[model samples]
Target: MGGGNTAEQAREVLMDAAEHLFVTRGYRASTMEVIAREAGYSRTAIYRQFANRDELVAAMVQRTTQRHMVSILSRIPAGAGPVDLLVESLVIVASELVSDPLLNTIADQTADGTIASLIANDSGLTELVKSTVETVVADGTPFRPGLHPNDLAQFIIATALSFLMKTVPAVTDPAVARSYIETFILPAILQESPEPRRVF
Candidate 1:
């Protein structure tokens, strides 16, 4: 319908303006009026799309993180081993934080940087991680007993996101990053290690 299309388009335009301003000016400095002016629209238009600047910024961050995740994960091969796939998934996340244009821009501009919290908090991403776990372990593999699939997924996603925010040199090398992640995060749910558990 003409109504929805025009509204959706206007929303996208406003979001684009907000994203640029946020990247160039940081979250605190970017204002609703400034975003509307940059979008060449009235403040009324933004309010139609979003209740406030916080809502608009949250939406933009969610969209941007989703886009980045989809792009990075799409590159992994389908036939790879489950552990390999999971490790690579996290490695790609780390690599993107340091390299992806939008993420790099956000890191440079914000004081409390990282869109990871936004992504990790979103139900969509949680669902995505669960779905990925289901899909990857579909080949007769089982997660360790006492660990819910969703809980395992949440642990992996949270650890991966936290690691992504760090600037460690090990994460700079995709191969090394993958190895560390495999040894660190995957062992918990995978329970592949024979070593005795130390701490909870």
Candidate 2:
């Protein structure tokens, strides 16, 4: 089954080509013109799809995050507890950020601070990831009741990057990583340690 590539399809094709070029060369090297030529499209067509190089990079990030999240969510074991789910999600993200070809390429090729600034400036990414995770998990799956989903989602993103940057040895042992997250991170962030009621 084949048909002419629609605008959406063309945009995806451009992203794919950009990802390859970024991996082989680098983010700075994979210019819009290069991407356009790689995708077999004109610069005008690339402009129609993305206003600028930043927009193209953002689109690639969004697509990768969505695809990776869906893949990770689909594999969660049934009856996994809240802490387990969060831990699993973070673990998968960390692993993929370092190992996945697309994400790893971005990490390696992008100039220092480029990805960080992109993440910080993307205000909607937290909500997007949180909502996507909620929609995918079964109802009543028991995410941390007290922690805001936004913070949790953002923390996952931040922590994953930290792990990638640090090359955390804990990640080498899945069981160790899970234990540490459950024992420390989950309790610290998710536990509803309410302030004791002040008695006047």
lDDT of 2 by residue, 106-135 (tens): 454354465645753555666677785555
- TM-score of each predicted structure versus truth: 0.75, 0.78
- For 1-200, candidate 1 gives per-residue lDDT tens digits of 11344877888888888888877776667779888888888777778788975467567756766776687677878777776677677887766665644454434333344455555665666776787677766545645656766887788767765655564456766766766665666567764643433221
- As for candidate 1, its clashing pairs are none
Which has the greatest TM-score?
2
Q: Which sections of candidate 1 miss by over 4 Å?
A: 1-5, 104-116, 137-139, 167-169, 193-200
Name the lDDT value of residue 177 in candidate 2.
55
Candidate 1 TM-score versus the reference: 0.75
lDDT for model 1: 0.67
* Candidate No. with top lDDT: 2
TM-score of 2: 0.78
What are the Cα lDDT values of the candidates? 0.67, 0.68
